[model samples]
Target chain A: MAVHQRQTVPQAADRLMPSGAAHHEQVVARQRRGRIWAIVFQAAMLAGIVALCALLLNILNQSFGYVAIVNTIDPAELAVDGVPLNELPKENLVEILEANISAGLMRRYEHDIPFAERSRENVHDLILERVVEPQVQATWGLFDSIFARDSVFAEADERFPGSDVYFRSWLTTSFISKSQSSEPLRAGVRTAIFGSLWVVAITILFSFPIGVGAAIYLEEYAHKERLLNRLIQTNINNLAGVPSIIYGMLGLAIFVRILELFTSGAFLGIGDQSTANGRTIISAGLTLGLLILPLIIINGQEAIRAVPNSLRQAGFGLGATHWQVIWHHVLPSAMPGVLTGTILAVSRAIGETAPLVVVGASTFIALDPSGPFSKFTVLPIQIYQWTSRPQDEFRNLAAAAILVLLILLLSLNASAVLLRNRFDRSRAIA
Target chain B: MSRSAPIAQAAISAESMQGPVAGAESTSESVLGGGPPLDLSRKPRVAESLIQGFLFLCGAISILTTLGIVYVLGRESLLFFANEEVNLLKFFGGTEWQPAIGRFGIWPLVTATFMASLIAMAVALPMGLCIAIYLSEYAPQRTRSVLKPILEVLAGIPTVVYGYFALTFMTPLLRGIFGRDIVEIYNTASAGIVIGILVIPLVSSMSEDALSAVPNALRQASYGLGATRLETAVRIVLPAALSGVAAAFIVAISRAIGETMIVAIAAGAGPNFTFSPFRAAETMTGHIVRISGGDLSYDSIDYNSIFAIGLLLFLLTLSLNVLSQWIVRRFREEYE
Candidate 1:
């Protein structure tokens, strides 16, 4: 019995030792594999952050750089009575514009905004664009401008002997205030900004009320069991996924063609009959309104649905009608969420170029939109047009425009976030 | 509560007393004298009906918009097909695309669109999956919150800006990597890369939702079987969330197909039927924009062609979106 026990104990020991060791090794190997995968995942996240940084860096590099400006007619030469062109009187600047450009162009400009009523600053800009006609002979990106300043200057001097080399930010205050020009130095985004504002304003006017109303009906009034209601709900969900360019096509077919009279202001007798057609701000707005309508409706429904059922029940107990309960309690509580959605939708609308392009936003228009009926150019189209140009300076201008657009979009989103946060905090306290 | 109850009762009594006087003053004197007291509540009911009607009208507009889109696309596409100058057989089967000289072949645009979309998917799918896996399985709450919004910011940046980035930055980088001769100035590769970057947020967000929706018990079971985190994530979690991942991929592909500004600005204007990503090519959306942006006269064949292209694009994206929705609905895992 003692000999049998001894042999069994040794055999048990031998079995346990190898198996335990193998288990330990397997766990270690798995841990190593896990660590590797964790690194890979982290690397992917890092790539996203890096890509974002690169995009911003690239835009910044293009927006501000060393530019060699060589005017066709020197500002000093154009100075009248010892007054430099930069400091020239409004009258002198106007005279220069009238003298240089064609009579037809001058007449059109005057007719569009009236030269007599023009601001002094406006006349100054006109002189810079039409008279001086400053051309960028060479440009260096932000990196080269700073690190290789001497080399850039040398190259500029070698290429454009008389040109003045300066580090310029294309996004000056004047950039937003001045009008577009063939000359990159004179090009600005004033008309485009105004057009964008007009389109966005109209988009909001059309979309917000309709979107919210649809949400109210779908969430509070429509019975889920009803086939019609289910169909409407399904349609809304699908509409949200429809490509934006399709909306542009719809705008082209309907607003630009079928509804031309109303959109072109011919019916209202308000627009320039000759140049103005259905491709106007109103059409673009309505198209974008359609583009974002589904987004707003879906978001609005979500916000309304998020309102607790207890609140509705309590209102009913107080003898409040269904409509009254929704109007008074549901809407108020859902407002922050609704506004958040609207802000997102508006941001999307502002950044949208596809639908607007399809809706026939002008690629270049110096004149600001007079009203909804006027032909318009938005910021995206302006940037697109500039980027398509061959000159390096136009790319710089496009970069600057991108910065403006980003800032505008980010601020709008940030404000919405802040507002939502405040609302959430207030609600939590209550 | 007791103290406020008496005040509420008094206010109600006062309101009831004043209600009759207000009603009598507001209503016609003859009706007030002879007929039963006016049903004041009926006024609110009438307003309620009016409001309901308006809201219902608003709801109907969305459905109308869908109908409008279908009608417009169909009507114009029919016009395009009816024109004798545009041959339907050549449009479907031919490789060449020269609209100016009267060749209306569409294969070039379709091929370019497919090439760019394929390139975009190649970059976006794996990276997006990695991001989703990390966010769902690895990231702490704080990191997720910080990272998610930043990714959304990437989504929010204007597509025109991405176009510019592709033109100036991505193209130059590609030229540096593959000798200048290989990569054209307006190659599809750069645009495809930028587009991939643009869609990363979309793919990652959708996939993360899918991964997060996976039941924790499956993960726990895998762990109980002595599986590592990587093994569990790849073998168990990913398989369980396969439909969701596929849906995200399909949706991203649709978005890439419909994307306009990037391709319009960065991809070359000419429609080349080449399968090479490094060459200049135009997509269907790009072709539509380029033609429509020009001064094409009404009733001209060129004008009609854009609508035809638009119709094709619409069908492609619509089918993809519907498929994605169907997949999500059909295969979604519901864990109690």
Candidate 2:
């Protein structure tokens, strides 16, 4: 009788649970849809990451791969066929190799081939040497000629022309040791590197103190909601986004022409004295400094803003002056962020070739810049000069320079990150 | 006992305090508890007034920069018009740009600049929007983490590199694909395409932020109403984020307009006023670069031309930037 009663009660319970059962089903269905959406979102992000990796990999392969191959050309053979460095014998081999390799690599390296010099004695003498020597040969014996059309092996020269000595490594001790050349094969980035460094150094010196000072004055001392405050805020934002080349034009008009303290005179000045007045490193740096000043101010302001109001209150409570509170407490707390911003600005300045180019960062200068007043070039400008040449050797030089630039940019960014992490950890401990 | 103890304590305290009271009287009693409390309370207004002055000075710097724009551009453009025989209408409508031949018409260069930038935006918009969609909706957390930084890196690569890539790699690639040399080594197509690529990050990052701002609850509601993930995204979240995304797109367009190196390097040095993407073209900034390349004096018409171009370019970008700010303000919702 009791068992029968229990069965009857369960039946009643089932009837009562009909609405609750439907609601439970509805909740489960919604959750299933949410999970599916989450999966889809995750998948899309993964695809983006994969695509990004592929692009970077492709750039590295093309750029660094060329570096690896160019490092093989025998510098001595290249030097023997001198005057213009494009006459280097092994450079031609690299071009042929570049053309036949992977379609992408072939396309990239096709313009770097070196040319041969005309024989000096007589018109017939040149023809005779060409006839006797057969001009181009494979480095790994005649057997390698079968694959000579391949882009990877095209750069190999069997022996130095006119001499039986086997030639190797076109990127010689002198490749890095030399100055800029119209011949892409012979061009080195030493001057460009120094120019870049000096330009960036001067830019930092000019922009940092001024930008930080302005930020401090605005954030710490300046009262809020005033007309002047509003104006400054608006200008900082607008200046940050102004086209850099506009600044270049301004630099040309203002520094090069208006003041004219330093006139361009050939031999003593840049390539054309009368035309390129005020085209010195100082002008370029100052222009860039102005270009990035707003960025610094905005970043500095944010760092200052991040300092807690409680700390300021505590400083006031301790009988510290307003300036004392900021100097002792707020600035120390904000230093890490300020440093990070400066690093990012420096990175931007280093990578920027546009405004600098607009302001006339010389395309082809054969010597390193010695001082701030010197006319100079940077890596990008050098790359532009090299890759523009009709010859193939310069293409390789451009690739190498690009690799160096990428490495430099990457390392700088990495250091900034490392510094931020270190600072954050220390702050946590404090 | 308690009353006697209290009386004894009071007598002892009164005896001790009497000497100090006499000493204070001898030193001349303080007045109004070291002056009125209301006087001390008024100090904040003085401090605030000083702060107001400091803010004014800070604001002046920005005002100066803005004023400098008008002064520099206005003065130079006026001088240009004064020196020129033709007026503003003819200059704007004129077909020729041969400065050496003494023609000062800037129409052709302007059109070409617009055409290239338009093409860049056309390419960048779809690709960037798609990438942002993928990042916001499709990618896994781990994937998003890795890819976001890489995209930023792509954006960060120097423009010079892009120029070289366009000149060497892109030109050849396009030529091969077209089965004919559709693009010259210095044609607008390569530079425009590279600019499109450069702008991808700007659009994608901003759009991602916009899309992320849409409430998850809305997506849930849409899904609960029997919509697919795509449907929900398109019909609900996308509409909600539309204004912000539009603002982002404009900013990207502005960036493309201002791009100099890629155009200067990949785009030919020619000032041809043609609309063909296959031809070498010049932009306003490009013209500035070209004009500034010569041996012109500060006050020369050639030098002044740069400022004229610069001023126009600045105004266009400044207005676009202002529009972007307006959009952000109009559409932004306060979410706690």
Candidate 3:
């Protein structure tokens, strides 16, 4: 042992002497590489965040610029009143454009002469300067106002009358307005907005009760040994990961044709069998509901699972019935989670265009859907339709519509967070 | 120490023996409260059975949802095959997807879907793992508390916003850098990259949980062995949490596959069977949207193709999800 210790001490002495200089250099080189890599990794992370922010800033800057610059064109200066609306004077152009948009020319540009043949600047230019620009300006202000509106936009509008304004409030009014011609400058997403509302309402109605009930049963009632229950728990988790487009396919098969329940049959015994709205709003809603069900169930289960077991035990010990224990004890404790889950699920449902599009939710209805079986169009589909057009105006409208949808989504999430905070505090107190 | 220690040990042993018996006695006492409190020999048969039944029913609902999924997918897929004569091998193996030519081969859509998912994983894995490392090892408690919630908010942003960002910003930026024709207005790269961004939160959050699950003692031992904090984390803690990290990756991949809006809005709808990520290509979901958009008859081959694609997608995602769950369950760390 003493000899081995003497050898180890010699090895240490070698490091202290010049003999181990190469080893020390090698160790230093390795440490330098490691430090360099760590620095690189940190820089890369910072770069990612910066890149994301830059992308967001770029979109905001470009779209706002488009709104500002494009709106500056005075349609009154390009007067050709003997001809189409785009040829009229800027002051007359605004009046004509508003009248045309109100007359549904904005939504159905194909019927207008400008759509048939691209006139000078197309009909979209006049529509842009008059209808869409003003509309986006108004809605943009409304959105800013929702989050404590500063005077910057109001000041900009006041400073630049009939010129480019700061927060174009036109998006709000444009969003509420109906669809327009391929001219994005004039197009709006009103039809899509109404369609999204209907679809979301139906999705929530279908998924909420079922999801919460399933969670309640799983957390508060299910026996540990039940194989069937175990199988379900497993499948729900799996289902949560299933691709959403698969749901669209399911909707197509189950809701559109085979079911033949809502509008698959001959509509009013007049339209050809091939020309019916087989894909109705009901099918779209059901498909979306199923798509988001697993999300709701998983979230609901987590929340329910988070509830202390002692609460249930306490309820049972207090002579509460089994249903009472679940209803009064377990359900209330998990309400915040359920609420957040519901909000998230609804947000997903509202934004889903693929599944609904597959289910034939793309029918361009002029008016709002009056019933579950009515033909519907949602915001994404509307944006898609507008953006797909060759005209540049449609692109602007798509941006404005996107802003509106973003606002709705943000508000919904904000409310959910608020609700969660309130419930969290209450639960802590209890 | 001598008196209290033995007494505490004796109390614990005695309580273990008596705990269950006492629990049962209390339960009986609640039900048979009108009788003697000491003579708790009765069982609350009705109460116990009722509770058991309620739980069984809950289990049954879950069973029902699963059955419903299988039933729905099975019935439609069966109907699809009953009406069409698609050679399964050719559908997957064929290099083209031209419906006008009567070729129902789906290789293009499958390729798009897989390529996009691969790109997403490629971007998300390293980035997510690194962020997990920062969160679990480096970040202070207050910083972690702040950053985690912000990351979650990023996840909660509606996919439509991501889609818009891809179309309006990412595509334009890429085009400017690479030249106009280098990237189409609607290309797979933008969607794939943005989808990666969408799934980052999922990957990082799950991986952090996994890393946290690794015992601190293991980390301390590695440090005691003269390893740096970074080395200990990368070598010891990460290895211990390898299974969990893998599961998180799989789940993130699954999420990328299922995502629709970003792809639908940003990815081009042209269904060309090409492997070029920069090209405008169609996905299985994208094709479903395109075909459904067109005015096709209910019984047309094009209509039936939707279900076929859906069935294939379902099978692919279902397996990934199941595998993820299996990995999570098999390697989950348990604490005393």
Best by TM-score: 1
Task: Put down candidate 3 lDDT per residue, B1-336, tens digits, no spaces.
Answer: 123231222222222221112233332333232455542324455765665565555445545655655666676556656754566666777778876676767888888888888888888888888888778877789878877776776776667667777887778877998888788888888889888888888898999999998989998898776566677778899989888999999989878887777777778886777777888888887777777778877666777677777777777777888888898789776755
Q: Per-residue alpha-carbon lDDT of model 2 for A98-194, expressed as tens digits?
A: 3334656444333343123322232222222222222222222122323333543334332232333232333445555667865343456778878
Candidate 2 lDDT tens digits, B1-336: 123322222222222211111111112233223443232222344554464455445445555656765777778888877775546876787878766666778887787778778888887887788778778766779877878888878877888787777776677777788745566667788788878888888898999999988888888888776565666776788888888899989898888888887787777886887888888888887777656654456677676667777888888888888889888888776555
Instruction: Compose the digit string of candidate 3's lDDT tens values, residues A113-232.
Output: 544364545555646654545433322323243454555456446755554544443365654674644334445677777788888888888778877777766766555467866777
The C-alpha lDDT values of all candidates are 0.86, 0.67, 0.69
Model 1 chain A poorest ten-residue lDDT run: A1-10
Residue-by-residue lDDT tens digits, candidate 1, B1-336? 223332222222222321111222223334323555454445556667788889989999999998998899888889988987677897897788786787888999999998888888888988999999999988999999999999999999989899998999999999999989999999899989989999999999999999998999999998887677888899999989989999999999999998888888888998998988999999998988888888868778887888888888888888998899899889877678
RMSD of 1: 6.7
TM-score of each model, paired residue for residue: 0.89, 0.74, 0.77
Whole-model lDDT, model 2: 0.67
- Superposed model 2: Cα runs more than 4 Å off: A1-177, A262-276, B1-62, B294-297
| Model 3: CAPRI class | acceptable
